[model samples]
Target: MPVPNRPVRGVAAGVPFLAVPPTRRLDQPAPVVVAWHPMDPPRTEAAFAAALPLDGLEAWRIYLGLPLCGSRSPAGGDEELMRLGYEDAVMNLQGPIAVQGAEEFPAALGALRGQLDLGDGPLALVGGSMGSAVVLLVLTEADRADDIAAAVLVSPMAQLRPAVDATGRRYGMTYPWGPASLAVARRLDFVARVDEIVRHGQPAVRLIVGARDDPDGFLAPGQRLVAGLADRYDDPARADLVVVADMAHALAEEPGVEPAPQTAPAAAVDRHAVHWLRRHLGGTAAPGLGAAGEEP
Candidate 1:
């Protein structure tokens, strides 16, 4: 499938963009961020929307380009570095900036949550690819979502991006603190630190990654995320690998092609993810946490 120069934009049949864009809770408000990265959306988004019912919360999606593979060829290979926290600032690019990396994604979005006046409502994040790592960093390590009720991620990675220059490419993004954080994390292994936070932050998530979706660089990192989530989730198999028969790196042959709420394993898993999130963020038919396995 050939990726467009721009990220594809289409409102799911009924889902519409909010005009006021309330980032936080106002009156019995429910807010959720459905985040996705470039060369990747179909694998995660549609199902996530299907799984969750939009009875109450204002659901929104984050579309970005995450650096996962050196190729960036739109061939579905995700590797490279500095995708450290998927899309506060950096995502996939078509030309010169394609390989460039950035930090402060989770933090940036956290601030955006505030800037959007999304501050202090019920917040939840559903991210795919490197965006998954960003969710963890903001939720557990950076702790942007302390006020948030829950977060859900499908296919997250751990520290897959490479080391950036102390200054980094983004002007003043690191200036003093960013570099320091990355440096310290590099030595002590931030992955371990985040794992501890997830244990206690207690955000219930339904994480899924493909077994055959190995991009070499992305594999080990994605696995680490699986292991960490497995530690937190009791039924690791059900919570982690939603494996379909002989799948490849990309979920299917095309993007934006699948129907919502279907019987196929891919469709079911996707629907489950959406359903679980709507439940997480609170909907008319919302179920509480620890009830991820209840049928959609």
Candidate 2:
């Protein structure tokens, strides 16, 4: 199911609200949608604090919402990422901070669970990039293993090697503790821990990846991940790799930033995102955001 509008604009930018509320009544159970934040997200808590959207849909579809367990990308929460760039010799020393960052993920889950401590419904994780990977990490290591119902992974990372490599180059670290080196060495590689989650996380998983999204949407990020999972694409949606005509990487950039216009295929993928989200969260699936330009 594609989003109604192309590029899927958030009613508000920089603010991602989870639809689930705190006082969830037992008589009326609802699913909780946990959106894993991008690496080092801008505002982890504030993103979930805003009011979620409930219009457009036929029913009053709503669910518990929360950001995923952690962030690692360029969201800027990990102070160490920026701080390390200033000190070449000390950058590797600070690399441990990112590895240790996983510690915060579970805590966030615990907090979300506490907020939704009401009816016994279902919990689903919706994560993008490494945020999806972090969701796996939290669910695998948490006490409430049976709470999750399903998951949605968007362009997830294949391993930690890419992160380490990029971070090392950015910070000018000559030591072996670069993001890639440290990921495997520190045991934080996502691919290394899939088994732990496979046994615990349930229902099913829906993965959305751009056919052309190289690792980190460039090199071999998506490719490496897809290859790693080879025949395990249970419900895969490998969309066209068309870059939204004028869009940038940040689909939700700040004000004055022009939104990229995704082609019909991209629009369908985007709607599929919302469909999965609303269904697991509350709404039912409708026709996808695609039209008769091609295959059905």
All candidates: CA RMSD (Å):
11.4, 8.6
Q: After superposition, how far is residue 127 of candidate 1 from its true place, in Å?
A: 1.8
lDDT of 2 by residue, 1-296 (tens): 11122112121222233333422222344455555433322123223112112212222222211222223223563455445544542234323433333345445445544443424446666554455555555555656654666555555544555654545555575445556545443454545654555556343455565454433532355444344343343433421122223322222323211223333433544455545555554442233432322322
For model 2, state the Cα shift of residue 165 in Å.
Answer: 2.9
TM-score of model number 1: 0.50
| Window of ten residues with lowest summed lDDT in model 1 | 11-20
Q: What is the lDDT of candidate 1?
A: 0.43
Q: What are the lDDT scores of the predictions, listed in order?
A: 0.43, 0.41
lDDT winner: 1
TM-score of each: 0.50, 0.55
* Candidate 2 Cα RMSD after full superposition onto the native fold (Å): 8.6
Runs in model 2 deviating more than 4 A are 1-27, 40-81, 85-118, 166-186, 201-203, 210-213, 216-249, 254-270, 278-296
